[model samples]
Structures are given as structure tokens and as C-alpha cells.
Target: MSRYLFALGQLVARRRWWVLAVWIVLLVGAICFAAGTGGKTNDNFTVPGTESQDAVSLLQQRMPTFSGAQMQVVFATPGLAKVTDQQVRAEIEQTMAGLQGLPQVAQVVDPFQAQAVSPDQRVALGTVQFSVSAGEVDADTLDGVDRIAGPAREAGLEVQFSGAVYPGFTADIPHTPEILGIVAAFVILLITFGAVVAAGLPIVTALVGVGIGLTGILGVAAFVDVPSAATSLALMLGLSCGIDYALFILSRHRHNIVLGMPAAESIPLAVGTAGSSVVFAAVTVIIALCGLTVAGIPFLTVMGLTAAGAVLVAMLVALTLLPALLGFAGDTVAKFISPPLHPGKAEEVARIAAYEPERTCGHAWGRFVTRFRIPLLVLGIAILAVVAIPATRMDLGLPSGATQAESSTARKAYDLVSRSFGPGFNGPLLVVTDLSHATGADAAQTLMGRLRQESNVAAVQPGGSGNGMLLIQVFPKTGPNDSATTDLVNRLRDDRDRIESGTGATYLVGGTTAANIDTSNRLAAALPVFLAVVVGLALLLLTIAFRTVLVPLSSIVGFMLSVFAALGAQVAVFQWGWGASLFHVAKAQTLSFLPIITLAIIFGLSSDYQIFVVSRIKEEHTRTADAIASVQNGVAHSARVVTAAALIMFGVFVAFTAVDNPIVKPLAFTLAVGVLFDAFIVRLTLVPAVMALIGNRMWYHPRWFARYIPDLDIEGAELERRFAHDAEVEVPQGITGVS
Candidate 1:
């Protein structure tokens, strides 16, 4: 693989301009294709085998009118004591008529006709049923709704839209986060390299790669159900990994140039070594992400594949395009970028030139940590434990409208409905009953009576029967995001025996709230399986790569700690509402997808640093035959690059929080925090400390397993050997080139 990568780098270098032009053409074509396709993203998260899905399927088949996209048009006259005024009613009626006249609107139910006025009568609720699913609703249909609501707004009445279609109307894939993240990455790169041109290369390469990947997603969305959230995630991963991969190779190439190796030699050498690590790291991430399919959820599968595609693009760009760009720059780049700082400069250059591990700050820290290995390990574990405490109480559920931004019209509608009608008015549970039998009507009536008797049931209304099936709208006392609502969903499903025996009817509880509950429960149930697959696969890969048992075991343990700490931080900020004001989030509830998504991405990303750092340690140990020295030198050699990469990823991920979407915010923040802990604490501190304590045992493996396991050569030991041999044979004695 290294030889092939080296040859590819050489080819790109020789044909730098052509290679660069090809990338440009590909990027521009992708952009044009994406724009031409212009497909909508669906945010629907449905599990096929779930009860909620089954109920939804039945509802669609039986009651087509009610099954379509439903929207609530909230009207309020804040100054008015009640909405009973004839003039106000007339204006609202006109609005309702206009809504009914819209081409996409299948039906509109006026509050006055339905007599669904609020208790205070200051608020009125009108229902609009669309002819298509919420995900299928076009922008023009939403615009038409807005146009119709203009009259009510002009009449001194507040009009707000709420429901599934609201997200569709407001959904957007913005470049602000990606642009900001790139800007932040550039600054970090500038600091790491201390050269403008050096820093710019990684940023430019990453942007190009990420641009292609993101545009590719748009193209993919034209045919498949790619959720809007998937694009954001892809963008986030693409930028971070793109920059990190390019930086890894660029850093190594620069080190070689500083050692006086020719650009041609250094470029391929860097590609063979650093580029190999990037490939291995990226594969681990891809494998981990692909493992999400084990959960058997379409949304997660799409998300994982989308992100993995982006990472793959980034890795390829690093190996191919970046090297070509580097080749084009050549000695000119060497002339501009500054050399390493003093304090045994020659020794440092020599070590880097030969790919020998050095004793830098990471080394010093490793030695210091070794002296107090037990204490450092304990402290590290304790800190993680402290942050992870909140994870135990983490609530796994999608955010309700209540958590929407205060400025959002949907939020105002949610608040208004909660204050007037009831909290449950925001998410009414649909008690769908299969009534193919002649006795179904009698069963429905008996079930309605029983539902009305329940203390938690706020109201029960017959939701009109059709096609031999009856639907009952049951409103609970709690809001959709409330635990009480989930409990109610479970309660209704569990009481199937009683309900079915008494009424001779089978009931399925489903609604926006119920769907969320079901989705969350399903994901929660699949979490263990997903974790096992991801962790187990990663362990196998790491063991194969490093040829060790303890190292992979320690790596997995550290990865979990970082993940737990990240989740804990998310729980603290989002779920516990601690410092929520900073993020402009008012409510305290974790999105159900946050943990699952975070674990998959973060675990994969963390492995990159772990493999790079550990691979260096193993290389040093092979050379020195001293575990302690290997630990110090290995950490010292790789720490700067690892830390720089982490900071770049951290900046990119943190910038994602700047996006307006609430779902993207927590995910970005969690990833940003996770990268920080994984880089600074786990990879840098705890890992080294633990390895130091373990000593040679860090490389321990079963004797039988050793014969079967092959060395991955992720560090490109063969490439290093070839480079050394070629240099010794080809270079003149007087030349001060890389040895």
C-alpha cells in the first residue's frame, strides 16, 4: 500500500499541474451537478419494524386525509381579552379560506368551525392538511402558506406556523459553519507551522476536498433520502479530516525538506509514511461508521455512509492532490517556510529525517508521568468519571418544539398552545385501532371510554373512522419531550391485553410524540449492539496494526473514557441546562441521536490520533529495545502533529455550533469537546502514563495469536528502509542530505 501510495505521489508530482487541473474540474463538475439536481432533504427518522411505524402505515392506508402532513396555524390577539370579536373572526376566516384555496392544501379546519378555541379565547388554532408528506412539501407550498397568513398578520393578529412542515420550510444547508471552521483551522495551522503559505496549503486542500464531498452529498440526495442533518455531519467530518490528513503529510514533507532532502524525495517519502497512517486511520473511521448499519436504522446508515464517504475523499485528496500541490510548490515552499527552533536543532532534524523518535515535550511529559504513573492514571480516570456522572442521568429523546429558539414562530405557537389548550396539545397521541371486524366500532367506543377514565389522559376525541379502521385522538397531560409522555406511550402499548380483550380490537399508539418515543427506545435498545460492533472491530484492527493485546485494550478503554466524558459534558450543558444560555438553548433535553452519532464519529476520529501516536511508540520500541525510552520518544515525536491535528478538528467542530439548527449545535459542541479531551488528556497524558506503567507488557499478545496476526506497517517501515538505502547509495559523501 505504501509503495503504491508512493508511486501515486510520484506520478502526481511529475504531473502536478495536470493532477491539480483534474481535481479542479472534478470539484466544479460536482458543484454544477449538485446545483442542477437541487433535491430536498428528508428529516423523517422512521424504523420500519417499530409499532409507531406500523400504526403510521395503517393510518395512511385507512385515513388518507388525516395521514397527510398536518400544520397548525396559530392566531393570537395579545391585547384582546378574547378572539370572539366579529372583525377578528372575519379576518381569520379569510386567512383560512385563502389556505383552503392553495393548490397544495387538501383541507383547512377553521377554529370557529371546529370550536377549538383556547380557554382564555385569546388564541385560536386552525389546522391545515397538506396533500403530500411533510418531507415531500415543496418550498412554494410553504411560501403560499406564508402569503395566505399575511392578512392575519396585518390585522393586528399574530400568526405562527408549527408542525412537521415547519422544519421543511426552514431547512437549509449553510456553509457558514464550514467556512468558519476552515478559518479557525487556518489560524491553528499558521501557529503550528509559523508560515502563511504552509498553513494555507492544508486549508485550501481541505476546502477543495470538503467542497467535493459536500456537493457529492447533494447529488446523492437527489436519489436517496439524505437528511439535512447528514450534510452538516458530512461537512463537519470532511473539513476536520481533510485538514488533518493534509497537515499530516505536509508536516512530514516539511520536516524532510528542512533536513535538506530534495522536494522529489521528500514528497514521496512523506506520502509513503504519514500518508499511510492517514489511510489506516481513515479506514478505522470508515469501518466504525459502517458498523452503524448493525443498528438496522436507515437514517443512521445513511449518516454513517455519507460521513465515511467524506472522510474517504479527504484521505484520497491528502494522498493525491495534496502531494501534487506540494510537488508544484517544490523548493519554493522550502524557501518560504521557516526552520525548526533551536536547542539541538541538528539532532532534531536528523531524528526527523531518519523517522527516528525524538524526546520533546511529549517525551518530557511521558517521563514525568511515568514517575507518577499510578497517580496520573488515577487522576485521569477520576476526571473522566466526574464528567461522566451526568451521562448516567442522560435523557435520550428528540427535542420538542418547546426547545426551539424563542424567536421561532413554531416556538411561539408551541408556547401559545401549551398556555391555552394544554401542554399535550402540542403532541396529541393517535390511538389507531385496527377494526376490520364488524365489532370494531363497539370496540373503539369501549376503548375511548377506558382512555377517558385514565388520570393522565387530558382528552379523548373520536378522530373519524374510515376503511374499517377507527382512530382515537388521545391528549396526555404532559408535553411531547416530557418523560411522562414516553411513559404514557409505553403504558398504552403494554395495556394491549386489557384493551384487546375488552374491545376485541388491536391498538397502536402513534403520533409525532409517540414516533419520537419509539425511535428513541429503538436506538437505545440497539446502542449496546452498535457499541459492541464498533469497539470490537476497532480492537481487532488496532491489534492487527500494532501486533499487541494490551495496547489495543488500553486504547479502547481510553477511547470509551473520552466518549463518556464527551457525553457527560453534553448531558451537563444540554440536558441539565448548565450554561445553556451560552448556546441560546432554553430547554434541557438531549437529542436522542446525539450520543449515537457522537460515539460513532468521535470514536473513529479518536482512533486516528491513537494509532499515529502508538505506531510511533512501537517504531521507537523496535529501534531502542527499551520500552520506557520508546514511550517518551514515541510521544515526543508524534505529539506536536497529533495535537495540531486535534486543534484543527476541534476548531472545525466547534464552529459547527455556530449553525442555527439546534440539532447541529449539541453535536458540534460534543465533538469539539471530545476532540479536546481525546487529544490533550487521553492520547497525550493517560495513554502514555498507562503504557509507561505497563512497560513491555503493553506489547503483550498470546503466542498462538502472534503467528496469525500480521504487522500492518502503518508507519511505513519498509518505505523508511528503502529511503535510507537509496539515500546511502545515491547521495554524494559531501552532500548534507537526509541520511
Candidate 2:
């Protein structure tokens, strides 16, 4: 470790151009690399082989051998007078004729056909099935939808179109993450250091890091199934956190320079202290996120690993690229157009004499903590407890099209189909069974009868896989989140043993509901593993940094309490009707993946802030040899800066909720509340109070561990001595404000 530090010192002292050139070349190459890669399929939020997918595949396979059409288009209004009238039919026919002429379109089922409408004839619906193979959905298939939809809207009728195509293609997935990432990087740096050049440096370094990372991820995609579109979000987050850590170190380096240290000496001095914190914080976040691999869901597992990979790249970039940039920029990096706010001579005098016995610990930290400790601790706990209240009532479920904005064509189409045909019109069920024996038919018939008796079931019919398969159409009573889906799944599972025993066959239930329920169950089962990883990783890193057994444990407890509080608050907003209209989501909307997503995102973010605070406190404690004094000084110094950073971060996250997509809203909501709680409550208040109470005893470590660990000089003692020796030179007359 010391050798690496010394090597870094040499690199700075020698002013190596190769390091800067290499970074520039790699960054430029990465840009070309990304541009070279062509567009790839997006599978981030897709489940490939569920029953609906299989049904579509089977239809495509049979399309070449068989008949007219399989999908439908419906026209709806207050009434059907204009739709059923002759002029309307002529216009509709003209549109249908245009569609029929297309090479890929097989046939257009006329809505005016008597068989299409129900008894009252309030709705006139059309059916369109393409001549193309059922096995694939390509441009030709989507073009057919657009061809008819475009003309129908011009005919002045209320028309909504729903099929498997729109749900798979046209849902509004927001693109806010990119803007959020750019803005977040700027905000964190500006707030942390208060210098424009200092703020801009992190953004530049992080972009290079993320650019390299994206190139690597694109390469990895050839060997694995990566979630295509949303990978950008992970890359963005890694860049933001990574850059923040680097700036933390660089700002400290600039502070040393301002105090008269030579540039070369300040580099190692900063690296040994803040650079070390950056590495540990990055690693801890990586570990927490990567813990999602235990869940065994390929989508989540891929996301976790990819996100972790990006953070690792960010760390390396910050350490290498940032140092070189700082070495190149020198004192000019801290030169702002506006002058720094200079503290009065009395404050300077007090700071210069701060090390004296009369003032050092007794006067500085002792006076401060005695005056303010209880109030700080009380405010923190109160905020955490209050904000976290909503998490307790959290309801978890899959996202649905009905939750989309009414203006979206997909949502409008879904509503029409659901009202005109059946509630589960968009998604139906498929039951697969082994049917090699006589009992197979009997068991299948019995299951069919039970399904027919269900109130929410619209119909049951034979489907693909020959004798073993049955397609059951369920009219979901309460839409996606209704208790009916969960109830039906449980009932089927309860009856599975008897049916399987009698038929000597295995039965599997596969559908939208079943797929959602299975995913929920898997996540629930994996929660313990995820929590264990988060807590275990925090303990490992904190122990290494603090060297105390109980301090890490206490920190974990405090963090867990904060997490519970955040989750509880989420529950109240989503499950209860606290802020429904304000957030623009359904009062009862629940995201099925909330727990796992929150675990990965919130845990990492919270831990990031926690490490920043604790690192400063630990630094102060080492300097003063007094626990309470260290806690007071560290909190006072860190609180304002961290709070501002957190506020900026919170704004970036909260902005995403305004987008018109269901998936993005939950992510934004959880992240925003979590950041606020972590910034103001958990990090600012609870952590400081606990450190104050624990005091000097927090550094206690086993003698066995201490012996193996070499001492790291983060105090800048050598550089300070060198600068003091060089201070005999006269100050420049132009710089009139010298103390």
C-alpha cells in the first residue's frame, strides 16, 4: 500500500504526460467504440418464455399452414351510430382495403360484420390478422397496426387499438435518467467544494469513466443476455457517486495547497486520506448492489453485476485520470472568478492557535458538543421515524398498462378491450400438463370444469402442445392488483397435488398473474440473503476502516432503522392515499419489484452518505484523541456540505417521477425519499449522536488484527513541515489578503 502511495507521489513529482495521454486516448476510443456498436434488442423488463409468449410463438408457427387472422381492432364511442352507418362503413372499407393490399397483412376482419358486435351493438370491433409467420413480431407486423390506426383516427370516431404488439412496443419508458445523471454530477461537485473549476473537474473525469465502462459493457453483451435500454441508468449512477468521491479527495488536495503545501507533497497527502475513503466507499457500494445476484432472476442479477462493474471502472478512473488532471491543472483548478469568502482575522487567529493546549480539545469540540449534542440527535431520529412511516404499509405487485396515462394509445386501447370483451382481455392464462395416459384427459377435463366455474373466468379452450394444453381466459375482477389473481393462484396450487396424483402427471400454471406471483415469491424468499449481504459487507468495510467491533454493529443498526423508516413512508404514499394526485400515480399502485430494487438502490445510496460522514468523524477522532470532541467537529464541518449534496441528489431523483411511465415513478419516489432521509436525518443526526456517545472506545481493535495492519500516515505531517520550512519567502504584494 505504501509502495503504491510512493509510486503515485513519483508520478505527480515527475509530471508524467503518458498518464494524461493514455487517459485521453482511452476516452476517445470509448466514444468510437460505442458508436461502432449497432442497436441491440431491449430485454431489461421483458419475460421471454411465459405462457402468452408461447401462445404467440405457437400462433406464428401455425400461420403459414392455416387461416385468416388471430388479433383484433375495436372502435368505440358513446354510441355506434356513426360507426355502423353506411358512410362510416365505406370509410372503414377504404381503410381495410388499403391494409389488405399490404404484402404482409393477410386479412382484415370487418367490424361491420354482424358476428363482430354484441346484442345491443353499442361497440363495433374489427379483427386483423397478418399473413406473416406467427413465430416473430417484426416491422411488417407493427406497420400493419400503424397503417390502420392512422386512417381510423382521421375518420372522426373514437378508436382504440390493442393487441400483443402495442404492450410490447409502445409503452412510455422515460428518458430522464440521462438528464438526471448530468445534472446530478454538477450539483454534487458545486455543493461539496464551491468552486466552478473544482465542480467541472469531477464531471469531466466521470464522463471518461462512464464512457470506458459503456464500451466494456457493450463488449460483454456479445457473450451474455444484458438488459438492453436501462443499462444507462446504472452507468449514470456509478459516474455520479464515483465523481463525488474523487472531488472529495481533490478538494482536500486544494485545501492543502491553500495552506502553503507544495503540489507534489499534497497529492500523496490527499490520496492517503480522502482517496482511501473514495476506494472503500466505492467498494462497499459495489458489494451492496452485487448482493442481488442471490435472487437468481437473470434481469436483476444482470443489472446488479453490470452496475457494480461500472462503479469499479469509475473508481479506477477517478484514482488514475483525476490525479493526472489535478497534477496538470495545479493551483489554477482552485482559481474561481469570484474571490473566496475570507474569514475575519479573529477566526484565522483562532484557527492558527487551534493546536494550543488551552484551546485544542477542551475549547473547540468540548464547548460545541456540550451546547448542541442532544438537539442534533433528537432532530435526526425524529425525521427518520416520521419519513419512514409509509414503508410499513407497502403493497408489492407487478406494473400494469392500466396504470399508464390515459393519453397513451396503449392505455386507451387496453381500456376499450377490457370494457367491451372481458377484464383479462389483454392477457389470458395457459395451463400445461403431461397427457400421455387416459387419466391425462380426465384430469384436464376436471381442471377445465373448475376453471369454467370461476366467476372471473371468461372462457377455456384447447391451445398448443396438443392434448396437454388448455388456454384459460380469466376476467380479472380488480385489474392487475385485485386480490382475485393472488387468490386464484393459491387455489390452483392447493388443488395441484390431488390432480397430479390422480393423473400421474405434473401440472404447471403459467400466465401473467402466475408469472408475476412466482416472481414475487422468489424475491420474498431471497430477501434474507440480500439483507445478509448488505449488513455483512457494511460490517467488513466499516471494521477495516474504523478497527472497532461495536462501531460497525451500531452503524448497521442505525442504518437498518433508517431503511425501515424510508420503506414505511413509501408504503403510505403508494398503498395508502397520502399523496396520490401529487405524484400522479394510482392511489393503490404497488410495484412488485420494489423490495429488491429498493434494497439494491437505497442501500448503496445510504451507505454512500454514511461512509462520507463516518470517514470525517474517524479522521477527527484520530487527530484529537477524544471521541465527543471528534464527533462535534466532524459533524459541524460535514453537515452543511453533505446536506447540500444530498439536496441536489434528491432533486435529480425526484424529477423522474414526473415522467409518464409506471416503472420509473416508483424508482424515482423511493430514491428521492431515501436520499432526503439519509441526508438530513440518518447521516446528519443519528450517526453524530451515536459517535458522540461511543467516544474514544470506538477505535478499539483486536491486537491480532492491528499487528498485521501497517500504519498509514494520512496526517500530511511531512508535507506540512516542508511547507513551513519554505514559508520564509515573502508574499506577493498583488495578493494583498495574506494572513
Backbone clashes in candidate 2 total 14
Query: Over all chains combined, what TM-score does candidate 1 have?
Result: 0.93
Instruction: Write down the RMSD of all candidates, one decimal each.
Output: 3.6, 5.5
- Which segments of candidate 2 are over 4 A away from where they belong? 1-6, 9-16, 39-41, 44-74, 82-140, 157-177, 180-188, 191-194, 215-223, 339-372, 433-447, 461-470, 497-507, 702-739
In model 2, what lDDT does residue 51 have?
41
On TM-score, the leading prediction is: 1
- lDDT string, candidate 1, 1-739, tens digits: 6787888888898899998999999999999989999965787667888887888787777777667667888899868546778989898999999989876677788889878798888999887877677777777778888888888888799989898775334567477777788788888876666567678898888889889998999888888888788888888898899999998899888877766778999898899888878998999888877877777788888998999999999998999999998987876554444345543343333343334333245566767877888888899899988998899998888867787778788888999999989898788888887777646446777878888887678888766577777778788998888888888888888877876775667789887788888888878888898898888888888888888878888888988999999999999998888998898877557888778787888788888998888888887887787888888888877877888899889988888887767788888999999999888889888998888888888887788887899866778778877776444433223323221
**Against the true structure, candidate 1 has what lDDT?**
0.81
lDDT of 2 by residue, 80-173 (tens): 4655667666766666667666655655657665244533554566655555432234566567667666766686766666543432353434
lDDT against the true structure, each candidate: 0.81, 0.62
